[model samples]
Target: MTTKENNYTSLEVGTFESLLSRNYKGIEGKFFIGNELGLSGCEVSLNRLPAGKAVPFVHAHKKNEELYIITGGNGTFFVDGVEFNVQEGSLVRVAPAGARAYKAGDKDLYFICIQAQAGSLTQATHEDGIILNTKASWMNGKK
Candidate 1:
């Protein structure tokens, strides 16, 4: 059986790259959607970073699992206290509550980042910083 295609096309990430002057500028991330035909359960995005640039801060997620699939350029990813060299064709996954950070190497870097939502709200703080969300009303407002 053949079914008619949807009236709208799936989001294309790479196509939007040209619309911006700097691939990674002004925002926390630079991204475009590729094909979200079968996307489910998790959030996916295409991220690009210029040479010598860092994405976000050095923090970890308390209840979110994330994976980075390197599509181009070199990316250095710090996972769980170790630094892993990421490049084209590299797939890195950071489990929930694990430490993770990434930076572009000497060249521009592009990759697809997949983040699976946690069952409940997640709180994350830097490795050396104080607990940003220590107080929780659900937990009797304890830190």
Candidate 2:
């Protein structure tokens, strides 16, 4: 007995790109955006941090969980007030409403970020000059 296989051809690929606005807290970079497959509560984006720059000051969220997977270069990862050295193939995860921040170490940094929660992700400045997480809902209508 022989089994039959189904063949599929490529038509088009789905891609999402969002331009960073001047009013945004972060610097300029291509944001490869996308929604989770078959799920409405999660989203993902790839961020490129240029040399001598930081992704976000230091922040926490209310209902969203974020993970950063470093794909190139080196960087300093700060989580919950603690610092960690991260490089290629590093994975850092921040829980809902957890404080975190990171900076590229002497070189450009490329990483994949995933966010899953009930609202949008945002950043705010704290009294001590530290960055804090506001709410993810702020991005609801802006997109």
Candidate 3:
């Protein structure tokens, strides 16, 4: 069944676009599931990096955490000065305070980045007894 509010056609059909802001260098991105999807607790995006290029700089978040899932090619991810090689199926998690950056391999690299604020989901849904109709808001265009 399809729900206009939340049911998206498919990631395969999702258009890959340049990252919204050009402030950063060496990366292109498309936001697949975001506020448009009625998501408040988390957001997802597809990131692509060309060979020999890397994210412009290392950065850390103040409230949100990020998880990166490598989908194609390979790359080196640096978190808080530590490096890790990532490839297809590799998953990396970075906490709010963990500085991070990455470089694409010889070939282009593609990955999915999922981000959410720490404790926001549980606090809003369970602890606060606020039932969020995340899907419905997408169709209605309001939350």
Best candidate, TM-score: 3
Worst 10 residues of 3 by lDDT: 15-24
Candidate ordering by lDDT (highest first):
3, 1, 2
Model 3, 1-143: lDDT tens per residue? 22453455323333333443322233455445574456655888777777778887899999989999988888899999899898989999899999999998886777889998866664443566766667554687665
Return the TM-score for each candidate structure.
Answer: 0.61, 0.59, 0.67
- Residues 1-143, model 1: lDDT tens digits: 22226554444334424433434446444653323444445667767677798857677776678888888889799877898798999988788878788898997777788787765335444544665657567788555
Of the two candidates 1 and 3, the one with more favorable lDDT, higher being better, is: 3
The residue-by-residue lDDT of candidate 2 on 14-94, one tens digit each, is 222222221234466545335213334466666666677886567888787898888887889888888998888999888
Give lDDT per model, in order.
Answer: 0.68, 0.66, 0.73
- Which portions of model 2 show Cα errors greater than 4 Å? 1-26, 30-32, 35-39, 118-143
| lDDT assessment of candidate 1 | 0.68
How big is the positional error of residue 57 in model 3, measured in Å on the Cα after superposition?
Answer: 0.8
Model 3 pairs in collision? none
RMSD of each: 16.2, 17.2, 8.3
User: What's the distance in Å from true for residue 101, model 3?
Assistant: 0.4
